[model samples]
Target: MSRQEFLVDIVIALPSDLPPERRAELVAAESARARELRAAGSIQRIWRRPGQTANVGVWVAESATELHDLISSLPLFPWMSVRVGALARHPLEDDHQ
Candidate 1:
């Protein structure tokens, strides 16, 4: 089967007075989601900056719909605001050359 990929970037608008404990909890929950994705072998890599305003991750899936479903499965989906920068596939070498 051919590998599919998406490039996603998220920017978070953090709430004021967000406590450290709550932040930790949110992170823990997100980590669990990541673990699940890893177990399913769909996630390619995840890059996160806790103290910053954004996190980025790459996902490999069978289709774009699958990627959407995967993102919806994350706990952060409800409250966490995000902006998807780009969602596209890289050109195959044969196709490009």
Candidate 2:
């Protein structure tokens, strides 16, 4: 049995009025969780948007259900507004080699 790998693009938004200390705590926890996912090969890369509180990330999972589970497990999940997009390899890119 082969597991299909999916590329997921994620955008994360946090509430603007959250307390500074709480935000710090959440950031710390989220970073730790992200590290775990990276080590497990679930998360590929993450970047913070310039001049914004949002973040963008690339993730890989065997299925959408597994991806949802991973996102929902983040410590900051409760406070985040997230958007996810599934990506497919483009034919042009595939043929570039």
Candidate 3:
């Protein structure tokens, strides 16, 4: 099946009582996994909201189920509050070439 696009907004809220070292470890692993997804084309674009623990990204997957699986693969998924929207091709973006 052809891939579909999804827009994702995520806020990572680790408990304030969580140990700093554990937070660091999860962050490190999350970064590595995100890189892998990007290389694999699952992550199309990503941006961080400055001065916040949040990010927005465009992702590609075969289906919403696939998208969920991909996002859940992140090491910090359990600590994330996320929103995802399916994206549709813009009429102005038609490729006739």
Which RMSD values do the candidates have, in order?
Answer: 3.9, 2.5, 1.7
Q: Per-residue lDDT for 36-85 in model 3, tens only?
A: 99999999999999999999999999999999999999999998999999
Judging by lDDT, tell me the better candidate of 1 and 2. 2
Tens-place lDDT digits, model 2, residues 56-90: 77788877788889988888888667777777677
Model 2 has an lDDT value of: 0.77
TM-score ranking from best to worst? 3, 2, 1
Q: State which candidate has the highest TM-score.
A: 3
- Model 2 pairs whose backbones collide: none
Stretches of candidate 2 off by over 4 Å are 1-19
What is candidate 1's lDDT per residue for 1-97, written digit by digit as tens?
6657777776666466879888779778877987999788777777887888667777787777777788878766765665544355557855987
TM values, all candidates: 0.64, 0.76, 0.93
Which candidate number maximizes lDDT?
3
